[model samples]
Target chain A: GAGVSQSPSNKVTEKGKDVELRCDPISGHTALYWYRQRLGQGLEFLIYFQGNSAPDKSGLPSDRFSAERTGESVSTLTIQRTQQEDSAVYLCASSPGQGAIEQFFGPGTRLTVL
Target chain B: DQQVKQNSPSLSVQEGRISILNCDYTNSMFDYFLWYKKYPAEGPTFLISISSIKDKNEDGRFTVFLNKSAKHLSLHIVPSQPGDSAVYFCAASSGTSGTYKYIFGTGTRLKVLA
Candidate 1:
C-alpha cells in the first residue's frame, strides 16, 4: 500500500471481551509504532517495532496489552479482557528505520468497549 | 505527571488570524519535537518537526518555536482557516535511548470560525 493501513475502522466490544486490531505498515518502512488516543486526551505511545522485532514494548500499560509484527509488515495489537477504559482510538504509524522524526500514520481503529 | 503537557484543551480563533498552541516538557533528554494534526475519526498526520540543535522551524503556514531553557514549544498557524480546525498534538522523542517511545501531550483543539 502507498500508506499505512489498519483494519476494522471501528470495533464495539463488550467489557471483558478480547479484541484484536491489525495494522499493515507502508511497504519498505522498517519502523512501526502503535498509540492510543482517548477522547480529548493526547496520544499515548503503546509499542514500537523495528523490522520484525519490537525493541520497545515498555509503553504497554499492563499485561493485557500485547503486540506482534511479522516480517516487518503486518502488526496486530491484542487486548485481552477489555475494560471500558480501553476504549480509544488506536493508531499505527510507520517510518524509515533510521529516521526518528518522520512518520506516516494510518486511519486508526476506534475501539469502543462498552 | 505528564512530561509533555498541553495545558489548554481548546482554543477559538478567527479566520485569517494566527492560532498559537503551546506545549511543555519536563524531560531534558528529549532532543526532537514534532507536531501532528488530527481530525475527528482520523489518525494524526505529521505536520512539522524540529531538532534540538535548532530553535525554530517553519513550513508554509505552520511554524514551530522551541525554547529549550523553558522546556516549552509552540506551534503557530498563520491565516488560520476553517480547514485548519483540528486537534494538534505535540510530541517529543528522547535522545535515542528511551525505547523509541515518543511522548505526546494531551492535545489542543483549535476551532477556526470563519
Candidate 2:
C-alpha cells in the first residue's frame, strides 16, 4: 500500500511570495493533518481536517497560514507573504479516522523562504 | 511555553546494548503518548504508543513506559541495532479532551554503533 506523499520535495521562495505545499494522503484515510518542523525544534501542529467538519485551525500560528482539504484525500497548506521564519519542513500525516492513534506521514516538503 | 520536552539532544549506544530515551510534559491533561522515529530528509514514522491508563506497552524490542503521576514517559529498545539509529520524537495528546491533535517534543538523536 502506498504511504502518504507530498509534492515539491523542496521549495525555495522569496520572502514576500506565497507558497503552496501539497499532500496526498493514503487512499481511504479520513483524517489529515499538517505540521511544521523548524530547525532544532519539534513538530508544530498547523491544521487538521476530519471528514466534512470544520478544520481544526487552532494550531495555525497566524492568519497568514491556511490549509484546505478537498474531501478526505489531498490537502494543500498555503502560506501568504512568507517570512524567513516560515522556512521549515512541512509535513503531512493521515490516519484511518479521527480517533485513530497511529498516523502515517509523508516525506514532507522543505520550504525555504529566502 | 513548550508543553513537551526531550532533555537529551543525543545518545549513543553499542550494538546489542540497551537504548533508553526519556520525555517529560508539563501538561497534566495529556492522556495518550506516542513515539516516532525519523531519518534525515524524511517524515517521522510511528514506532510505539501508550495510554495513560496503562503503565507500559511493549512491542518486540521496543517498549514504552508511561508515568501519569510524573507526567513522563520513556522508550526503551533492547539490543539496539544500527538500523535503529535516528531521531526519536515523543508526542502527547489529550484524547479525553476530544481533540485528535498531538504535541511533539524536540527530537533526540540516537547513534547505535555497529
Candidate 3:
C-alpha cells in the first residue's frame, strides 16, 4: 500500500523567507501528524490533525509555524519568516484512526535556512 | 522539559548480537509506548509497541518491554544485522487523555557492525 509522502525532498531558503512543506497521507488515514527533527535532536511534535476535529497546535514551538489539513488527505506546514533555527527535517505521519498506536511516516523534507 | 528521553546518543553492536535500546518518560499518564526505526533520508517506521497494561510485546526478533512502575521502556533486537544500523526513536502517548498527540524522545543512533 502507498505510505505517507512529502514534497521537495530538500529545500534551501534564505532567512526571513516563508516556506511551505506539503504532506500527503496514506489513503483512508484519518489521523495526520507533523514533526521536526533538529540536528542531533529528537523528533519534535509540531501539530496533529484527526478527521475534522480541532488540530492540536500545542507542540508548535512558535506562532510562525502553522499547518492545515484538507479533510483526511493532504496537509501543508507553513513556516513564516524562516530563521536559521528553523533548519530541520520536517516529517509527516498518518495512522488508521485517532489514538492509533502505530503510525506510518513519509520520507520527509529537509529545510535548510541559510 | 523533555517528557521522553533517550539517554544514549549512539550504540554499536556486533552482528548477530543482541541490541538493546532504552527510553524513559516523566509523564505517568502515558499509557502507550512505541518504537520506531529510521534510516538516512527517510522518516521513521513503526517497529514495535506496548501498552501499559501489558509488560511486554514481541514480534519476530523485536521485543518491547515496558515497566510502568519505573516509567521506562526498552526495545530488544536479537541477532542484530548490519541492516539494522539506523536511528531509533521512542514515543509515548496517553490514551486515557483522549488526545492524539505523542511525545517523542531524542533518537538513538544504532550501528550494527559486521
Highest lDDT, which number? 2
Clashing pairs for predicted structure model 3, backbone only: none
* Span of 10 residues, lowest total lDDT, candidate 2 chain A: A96-105
Q: How should the candidates be ordered by lDDT, best one leading? A: 2, 3, 1
Candidate 1 lDDT: 0.90
On TM-score, the stronger of 1 and 3 is 3
Flag regions of model 2 displaced more than 4 Å.
none
Q: Which TM-score values does chain B get in all models?
A: 0.96, 0.97, 0.97
- Looking at the true structure's interface, with contacts defined as alpha carbon pairs within 8 Å between chains A and B, what fraction does model 2 recover? 0.74
Q: What does candidate 1's lDDT look like per residue over A37-90, in tens digits?
A: 888777888988887554588889999999989987899999999999999999
| Clash count for each candidate, listed in order shown | 0, 0, 0
The alpha-carbon lDDT assigned to residue A11 of candidate 3 equals: 98
Give the winner by TM-score: 2
Worst lDDT window (10 residues) for model 2 chain B?
B92-101
lDDT of 1 by residue, B19-105 (tens): 999999999989999999989877789999998989999999999999999999999999899999998999998747634468899
TM-score for each predicted model, relative to the true structure: 0.95, 0.98, 0.97
The DockQ-based CAPRI class assigned to model 3 is medium
Docking band of candidate 1: medium
TM-score, candidate 1, is 0.95
Candidate 3 structure quality by residue, lDDT tens digits, A55-103: 9888899999999999989999999999999999999999999667788
